[model samples]
Target: MARRLFLHVGTPKSGTTFLQSVWWANRDALLEQGLLLPGRGVNHHYWASCVVRGGRQVDTIPAAGLAAWDELLAEVSAHPGDALISHELFSPAPDERAEAALRRLEAVADEVHVVLTARDLVRQIPAEWQQRTKHGRSQTYDAFLDMIQKDEQARFWRVQDVPGVLRRWGQGIPPERVHLVVLPPPGGPRTFLWDRLCELTGIDGTGMAERATRSNESLGLVEVETLRRLAGTLQDDGMPKSTQRLLKDFVAEQVLRTAEPEKIVVPARAYPWVVERAQQMVAELDGQGYDVLGDLAGLVPGSEPIPGRDAADVTDAEVADAAVAALARFVRHEELQRRRGRRRPPESSLRSRVRHGLARRWTALRARAGRS
Candidate 1:
């Protein structure tokens, strides 16, 4: 059995992606130091968490399916040293499920520790909205905020309610074994969070920072608003979830990402409530007696006056400008794909032929206009 198991359940939008990227990139080094990251791939923990949460649907289960948790347990039991399992999706499991999952981990290791990395709600709220938009959700920012603030049963609260998540997952584990690694406020050193994780997990993360590759990119107000509107249109047109997911990735990563980012901030009307909630969370976390790695007070929203346009208040003119910019990027990307021989073969259908012909003509017109 593993000597120690660190389970990093998360409060989403709290640097989870960056930490996971660093760990995966340095897996070899970690293993050399006797820290085993069990399972076959980067998403191994994700699938295992789904199984523990009782998710058996085709969409939720991975390729190896519902047996992922058992596979992970077997790997941990066979390993001789420390192991870490991480996934933000694991943070929201209810009390019974959370306890059961912990018991399973305890069975495979001599010691089990629950690690939660958290950030202030002031930053998390808008970030969560943008993340949902990336996942093809069409809810307006106003409605999203309203639901998070008023609906305790809202899915957002399940993963993001810091104290609540701790209460559920920390039960029965020694307070010292359950860690609350507070995410430093923005504008500090980029490696601060990684350093904190290393301190808790007893792994030397030297040179691991540069190996980190993936980040859940934050979208600008115009970009996110455009995606939000597109999501609504696609949903209304009965687009398949799979196809919509592909389109969402294309638009968010390829097209709209080229535009200047306009940071999303809490609107004045909602700022007070956000601050109040942050204070409540900080108070609760402080009282929980979980081992804290950084300042718990950092979880409170900072009072600095930030300047930016609210996503809920984007104008039609801004949307139009963003749409045109994104269209130009899309055309250039398609042309590049064609040049690289990556474009799909032409379809035989008349509609496909007509569309291709129109595209060729548009390219010809643009070339002529450039020459003139």
Candidate 2:
């Protein structure tokens, strides 16, 4: 049996979650079919990749996880058939770490391959902005636009990031070994991303059954403003880190049920250099025969260029719904705040609050002492 491994590195919001879900649900079946999807504690294969990519970013791969990685590789080496590991976070790693990890992977398996699914730039930018906002960012599309324009140094929106992403995982791997999956045209084909993976892996996607995928979408300036205003006013909507994550999946499923795309404006303050840089990158990649992931070559200029969308139709009803959502968020935030209040304040928090109160009381006490 050949020891081959397929690694799917995700560019977050590009359906990584769906693929993860697919592997998890079918783990037993896959193992029976002579395939492997490791789950020592959880099914976050990217954790191993992250460790392989070097640990500084998302908690130094815990010691247990580090040992687990070794065990995982051993399994891969001994397993009779093939295996799969995926985590899109791998897409952003610096080349050295990515290659270092791939090298480790290659040592364990006879063949190591890379897969990345991409959407167009026109949609990705705003989608990312919305993703940030959902997690408690208050940056307006306008401000985000400003950053995109002037923050050319920031790698998130740059075309440079795309090639950088590829160069990392593609190390010691042939171009053909790197498979690029373009999201099929909307409403065109079913499970296009999954089906493509099926084709790439020579597995039957249909047997796995199709389910909804998680995606990030950007809100329009107005819609974003609405959420921001609501966040400011609502005490509950604070979205503390812990609860926010758990809620995010639920919100993504229920609240954000598929909506239409929203239009956006890309002013000079937003992505000023993106147009030119992306075009340059596209040309550069095309010349190099590199398949530019997503629609970077097609990214538009100007504030009017709509970014990727999360949902659409911001009707009065939707706005009202969002308002209710804001209240729900506020309530959660307040609940957390109250819970925090009840806690023995971290000695630091207690001292700080008491010091300010004492300062105010001292003035009043001094006045009374003077009067006496």
Candidate 3:
């Protein structure tokens, strides 16, 4: 068993994707420094997802996926050194589920530490809504806020409920062993989170800035509203869920992602409620006495809100521009495919030339024999 295990469970949208990307990109360097980062690259999310969404049979999960938990433990155990595992999905796990996951890790770890990265709800709320939209949700930003208010068990509350996430994952672990990484507010030093992560994991954070190959890009107000409008049209046509997903992927990858758009932020009207909720969560975490790696003040909501039009107020004219962009992308993709088709085939093989030579020789020989 490893001497220590650091589990970076998450409060999603707290720069988890960027962190994961960096870890994966520098995996080789980390291994050289004696830390085992198991699984495919920097993400062992499928394994963590299987554990959190526990059930006898969940078709969405890959077959034999549950074995990933054991496999991860085995990797850590085989290495007589410290190891790290990360997955943001593990944050929203219910108490019982979180306990089970913890016990499993504890069985193979001499010491276990739970790491939770958090951000203020003011930022998290709109980010969560945008994430839901990216996943094919058709709700407008205003309707999404209403759903959060009305539904106690809504997904927004499930993962973003900071105190609840900490409680479930931090259950029996020593308060000091639980590390709360407070993400610096937007516009703070970009390297702040990376530096703190290195401090917590005892790994080098340098030479890794160039290795981040994955990033979760946020959609702009117009881009998202346009997609939502497209979704509505699909719904009216009774488009299948599978088709809707493909359409969303196409627009997101082919159209929306071509250029970084101005990000959507929590509206001015919603700012006060968001601040209050964040303060409540901050108070809860403060009482727990966890080892906070960054400034607790980072958890406080920022004062300035970035300007964005509400999704519900998006006009057809605004969507038309996005539609034109999507059409251009389609044309470009088609031209690329045509160019690929027009490329010449490679030269014929030596064996084919030999066969042709032999055939010609045989034909000449037969003709000569007949003449003789």
Going through the candidates in the order shown, the clash numbers are 0, 23, 0
State residue 82's C-alpha deviation in candidate 2, in Å: 1.8
Looking at model 2, report the run of 10 residues with the lowest lDDT sum: 349-358
The Cα RMSD of model 1 versus the native structure comes to 5.3
Better of 2 and 3 by TM-score: 3
Better of 1 and 3 by TM-score: 1
Q: lDDT: which is higher, 2 or 3? A: 3
Q: Kindly list the per-residue Cα lDDT of model 1 for residues 1-372, writing each as its tens digit.
A: 999999999988888889889899888899999999988766788888887777443365547856778988999999999999998988878789999999989899999999998888878888999888887788999999989889989988898888899889988899999998888888877788999999888888888989988877888987788777766655554545564456546667777785458888888778888888889888777767789988889888866536767675776556656666767886897799889998566743432332333244345445554665
- Alpha carbon lDDT of each predicted model: 0.80, 0.58, 0.73
CA lDDT, candidate 1, residue 93: 88
Model 2 score (lDDT):
0.58
Candidate 3's TM-score reads: 0.85
TM of each candidate vs. truth: 0.89, 0.69, 0.85
* Ranking of predictions according to TM-score: 1, 3, 2
What TM value does model 1 have? 0.89
Q: Which stretches of candidate 1 lie over 4 Å from their true place?
A: 55-59, 343-372
The TM-score measured for candidate 2 stands at 0.69
- Candidate 3, residues 116-227, lDDT tens digits: the string is 8888777788788777676656788888887786787987877888778878888899999999888776788979889998888888778796789888777777777766
- RMSD (Å) per prediction: 5.3, 9.7, 15.1
